[model samples]
Target chain A: MKNNKTDFIQGNIACVEGAIVAGCKFFAGYPITPASEIAEHMSERMFQVNGTFIQTEDELSSIAAVVGSSWAGAKAMTATSGPGISLMQENIGLAIATETPLVIVDVQRGGPSTGSPSISLQGDTIQVKYGSQGEYQVISIAPSSPQEMFDYTIWAFNIAEKFRTPVFVMADVMVGHMREQVEYPEDYNELEIFDRKILDDPDSTEGRFLSTEVAPMPIFGNGFKANVTGSTHDEFGWRNVSDPKVMDNFIKKLTNKILNNKSEIIRTEKEYMEDAEVVLLSYGSVSRAALETVHTAREKEIKVGSYRLVTVWPFPEKEISKMSENVEKIIVLENNLGQIYPYVRSAVDGKAEVELLSPSVLGEFFEPNYILNKIKEAK
Target chain B: MLKDIEHPLQKYIRPGTNYTTCPGCGNGILAQSTLRAIKNLELDFDNIVFVSGIGCAGWIPSPSFNTDVLHVTHGRAIAYATGVKLTNPKLKVVVFSGDGDLSAIGGNHFIHAARRNIDLTVICVNNRIYGMTSGQAAPTTPKNSKTTTTPYGNMENTFDLSDLAKSAGATFVARWTTYHARQLTKSIAKAIDKKGFSFIEAISQCPVHYGKVIGMRNDAPSMMKEFKSKSIHINKIDSLSNESSDDKIIVGELVNENEKAELTDLMQSLRTEVGTDG
Candidate 1:
């Protein structure tokens, strides 16, 4: 810990700084509580760097503006809470269907409406995956601390640009607003910046081939005629509402690009799970508490371990299934009411005992005693 | 502006039978004026992107135009238009949608884009009723207008487009009626030439939907006469005497000829500030 260089920063500020280091050049967002700090950080940094920051009138415009900025050859992003995220769903659908590269940070708070502003909750897990009208796969990440907020934001933009789809940094009030020490990399020179894919020859007919989902991307201002549309489209970006083959190919490739690459996208961390009887599965802010609980249990000789999920959207099913295969039991913990618990319990398949722990909105975190008691029960 | 008149769009309309407009509809006038403005401005045909959302007015960007047209999801024209404009900042981005599409469902985008003053021309057709959905109450519908949903008169107050734009930080805002085709056409041309967010609210007639309810669907020529008579300048909004019974005022050019920093300009400034570290 002393060897690593650490600078204290809030979770949202770290996210903004991380995006800048990751080469994010455009930010469009509406100011929402608990998440407004992301916009505020962007507002100041956008002026400090060669990036664009815009405060839209609402969440719809915020996401729309980011979509526009992304098309302009910038790594664009936006941040919002529950209500703003709801407003952004349609545009998010458009981004997914059109294969636009963007990063949306949803700093969730308690509510279906304007719930607790300062409080935290993980209620948007299902919505983040399936909130849009159609069935589209998404890449989502859950950062458990300020450091992860910074690191994961960089990874989020990289994945978005690589896959040419919208990626989610699904954080909550706890990790979004929390202040903690985050260490910057020793050599910042190693981070790879992924720019918008470009057409090599603007004049060649091959340049037009960049319109398809799997085709090479044509960057804007490259003097190419690349027509893009949100409708069911062909490789040429022309509307093909009547062609089933075109629809099938477009949807297949759009979903396949991310689905086939899940191994590379899915990331997880495991700690002392090989011989432990009880394993805790957690993500976002709850993982931090689970880590502490596991440490306490380890000292007490209860043989408890933890599995922390960094990338949560594809749900890290393969990693969890592999990690928990030998464990005697698994306990899932979160701030929302069983939002992700069912997935965890179903994955373990009764070979090991499965349980859930969801904290109420009363405070910042759950008591370590509660988690310790659950681990004892699992034994 | 004769030297500015362009082709493609100007040459698209065929001399044939009326297609689908209602018998006394004002959409024809709005579409015709838009066409005339495109011709008058001599805008590049290939670079002209006409974006529309789901509504009766959304059809304007469909078969009606020869240039690139994007018919997107409901209340999302502005979003797609932003995409188009940002990708090719040199392109002329024109958005056409109904009052409900822009002010009601799309109001969040409407005000935000206006506030940012993005360099896009938004031509909103305020027909006072949702025509495609049949007679439903719209954002601009009069409070007393009876519609399918509001059989007992609309209790919600109508949205005043000009006022909303002014408060939301639009650089240019204007209102024109279908009967003011020539003026509306010139206004549209001016908006296209302006370098910031320009909005033109074209008050239209929804005859099949609203006409049968208000008993105003007689002759198409007579409907034009009413539009010509009732339309007034927005500046006289305050000076108009309350004594007149014919007080349904359709004002024109509420706010015009103003300049502000565009979103691109702001981004450029930010880039300068962020410097080499980025």
Candidate 2:
């Protein structure tokens, strides 16, 4: 039975297919509204691909299991909303400190604390990057449509393995529940895959944490005598809290691994920015509204362009800064009050006027006219 | 070449690793018993992984054992080990943690893992107090016991871990004191052989913190004597008087049934049923 390559699917369903296609074999999650569909879909599909799906007791165990599965040589992931992500912060820090590769899909809902379960909001943008304590670099991707939800999820897993860090696919309720057409590849092997580097000689794992770049992961029961801990340690994965220099060198390597390679980690999409005077900056589901605003404003000779942030973390400052130089004003659009607006303002560095068109209330999207009004006002 | 005659299982100990445990701590004995169990089962060293949580007991596995070890965050070893087991069911996963790590902070994970009947062995070293952070009352701390955190004496009740495990659906549940090294080792071996969630709670001695406050002698031998006096075997539970049974530390295997399906096995069967096995 030959089926059409393109199928009308929900964004969360597309995410599940992307994960399975990307070789994700372990999923542990606690169901939450808007994000529960991802878990439901994974539960139905995971075992079909010989994968494991566990509905953990809570978000903490979900992420902890994902981290464990990753170290056990399985690509793992979990999905949740804002409040769930908040509960997972500690283990997320553990994953980062231990350099475990896994994926976390934060289907963005509203709130500081369970504010709105079914509403669409980008409030978790900053939380995803800075939610966990301590200084560290993270990779977070935003998907605007169902197609990007599928494609970026696979990219998130590849980058998670490539850098040996937890990657976040920041999807919002709008995209998560939105039904749209998605094109599935005939074969998953056609996509780029990045597996963690493993040491051939297990004996060489001694002093393992010393390497600054991505360290070769050693699986348990692999005769590596691998010792993995979340505490600050030397290269051998032993706790070394006494020495200041050990902590310094260890933390530096962790942050620099992504920050120094921002060129490869950061991505953005731009439309009609070549000669626009006013540019709308957005990400996640808000980008869809920005795109519509761009089309509507351009029809009115408003000279408005849109720059969608494909990668939210590591800030994409370079691209935004360069765009800031060409535009007379930059209007940041988000579903939250103004989380990413400050970053855009800082990136612009007074090169152009920065305005925020954030719909602070839950369960609402900024209509094209609202953003067009902002663009005209900025002009 | 004159080589000192060491214990037969000394080779299983990681080379050049020194004990981080305090003197008179029973964690070393538990570690040795774990290794002895693995040795008796003739399990390949390459096929075993030791997971530990944050505490004195958590250090029992990692730098000391030659096997692969993961020293995860406080109270999360079981959850982490679940991932390891489900990802590769061939691996023999064992978790070593303390009362505070397992029952106090990680109580939710402990019960849920048991309820799911995951295939893994969890060896909980119950010392009645949190030894790693000085003396602090733990979930297994006996009522009215004194510790740094409970200078006025603890008012809370303690958990009977084996009962908790049994009620939570563990297929194999047992409790033993550090003095019952032989029995503890045999129980561990049996747990390793069990196909579902297995829990062994070792009533380890924390003489430095817990014993000193409780008026017991602050030495390993004295603690062992106390355990011998207070312990009762499970087979004799019906013979003991109610008053004596209340104070006795029940020892021996309490549950060894495996009727319920294991988590990993169920997942694999589901995959096979769906024809998704690769």
Candidate 3:
């Protein structure tokens, strides 16, 4: 915890508080269900902190404004749901391509097309990873509780600023709406915040884009005369659309910047994984239920542990795959229909039998008894 | 023999022009007029950020403006520029895009930006068609004027973008053709100087697909000549309703008012009033 000072607040409000602590000076969003309180609270908080806030005409403009403010050297963000995220995919791609540092807080809701508005559905787990066009990698975090919601948001901004890329905090409906006590810094100065590395000597020949190491950002209005375009460009930010070599380098750098730093970016919390024969794996709100299952199964002398992913994307394949050697079975749990199951299965390979334990009901959390019964039934 | 001296505007031009417009494209004319506006007003490139969307007109600022420029995705220039302006009020943000990029897919952003009365100088080059996409019908395309998307002649009425801006609460609104180069330069300079949202619709000549579709000589000079004869100034018009008539293109400053509060200044004021230490 950053500070012992704690306040009981909603998950969405925790997120807004974390953002304000992270020194986010600009926010633009269109309010949607399960996440509307974020914008509602953020509007008042922004004025309190002297930050700019805009309730955009639509989701596309929301993301667009965030991207624009990021370039203008502001720590900018937007909050929306699955439906709003869908509208923002194209601009998200634009942000990725331009290497803009910003945060997108998607309070995950159920949907292929406007699914349950107020339900806890982890439907957007995979969508956030692969929603944007083209080949790109983005940092994503799935906070399990309101406490994690507050903590992980600051984490998201650090990764975004360090790598100069868009990061998503995919908090689901239950995690977003549930009220809980969250510890935060009383003095904003006590909070840890990171700013993107700036290109100090723009007159030098070195360009802004580098392959493996994160390149310094030449933010707008800084007199860098930097030309940034969504079209394929070289390190100098000059347009080079036709050259395949430039295009190859562009995509490679965009993804490798995050992938190379995966060790620090990927976060997971584990309990009793060393002695467990059966493992319960989940993220976001379902992880709470997984924790309960671990407690109940332990009472029966059955070896079971809970594995919660705090940072989901740049998926922690290596750590889990290594753990799979000890576990007999890894039971994946989610409120939706096994969205992350395939990735887990592929990561586990043949070391452990991996299967998804989707909730019997679409929106409800899995009861501890149901999970333990399913684990026993597989016996 | 040519004199051994540099062109006055050469200092503002950037290095790359390999992806530039056709020899007779009006974007070239409007590009200089824009640069000239910045020069005439003595604005520094360091303090100005040019944002443009996808189109030939969008290229005016990207590689040519010799300043910080953001060439964004199609139809979102206004939204991006809004962010830039609101974030740093010291930096003058200019959005240079085309008719198709502004009034078609970007219509909502264009109108809403006007409604907010943000401090951004938006110059929409109205070439009557989607020039970069090979003359598809655009929202600003004249009704019954044939285009690739409307080969049988466009059935929809065209948008008078200046009228839309005037009604949508833009503090400054003006319409000018590329032929009115001097006035176009002055309007752009004045718009940039204005406090709130300013829109300048530059009626450019697209002599390729648009020229062939509407029966022209297929040259910039001929289309530009037509612009000179078929134009009527707003000052000469007796009634506002007839300015949108098909027979003539209305030109000159339509509206220039700065009484409304600007978005960036308002944000700054709100931040000051509430304080930043919360």
**Leading candidate by DockQ:** 3
TM-score (0 to 1) for chain A, all models? 0.93, 0.96, 0.97
lDDT per residue (tens digit) for residues A82-112 in model 3: 9999999999999999899999998988777
Better of 1 and 3 by lDDT: 3
Query: Per-residue CA lDDT of candidate 1, range A265-290, in tens?
Result: 89888887878888888888888888
Residue range with the least summed lDDT across 10 consecutive positions in model 2 chain A: A205-214
How would you encode candidate 2's per-residue C-alpha lDDT over B10-101 as one tens digit per residue?
A: 88888877878787999988988998999999999879888888999988988788878888888999989988999999999999989999
Model 2 misplaced stretches (Cα beyond 4 Å): A1-3, A205-207, A210-212, A360-362, B1-6
- Write down the worst ten-residue block by lDDT for model 3 chain B: B237-246
**CA lDDT, every model vs. true structure:** 0.78, 0.88, 0.88
Interface RMSD for candidates 1 onward, in order: 4.5, 2.2, 2.0
Docking class of 2: medium
CAPRI-style class, candidate 1: acceptable
Q: For model 1, how does the per-residue alpha-carbon lDDT over B63-91 read when each residue is reduced to its tens digit?
A: 45655555667887887677657545777
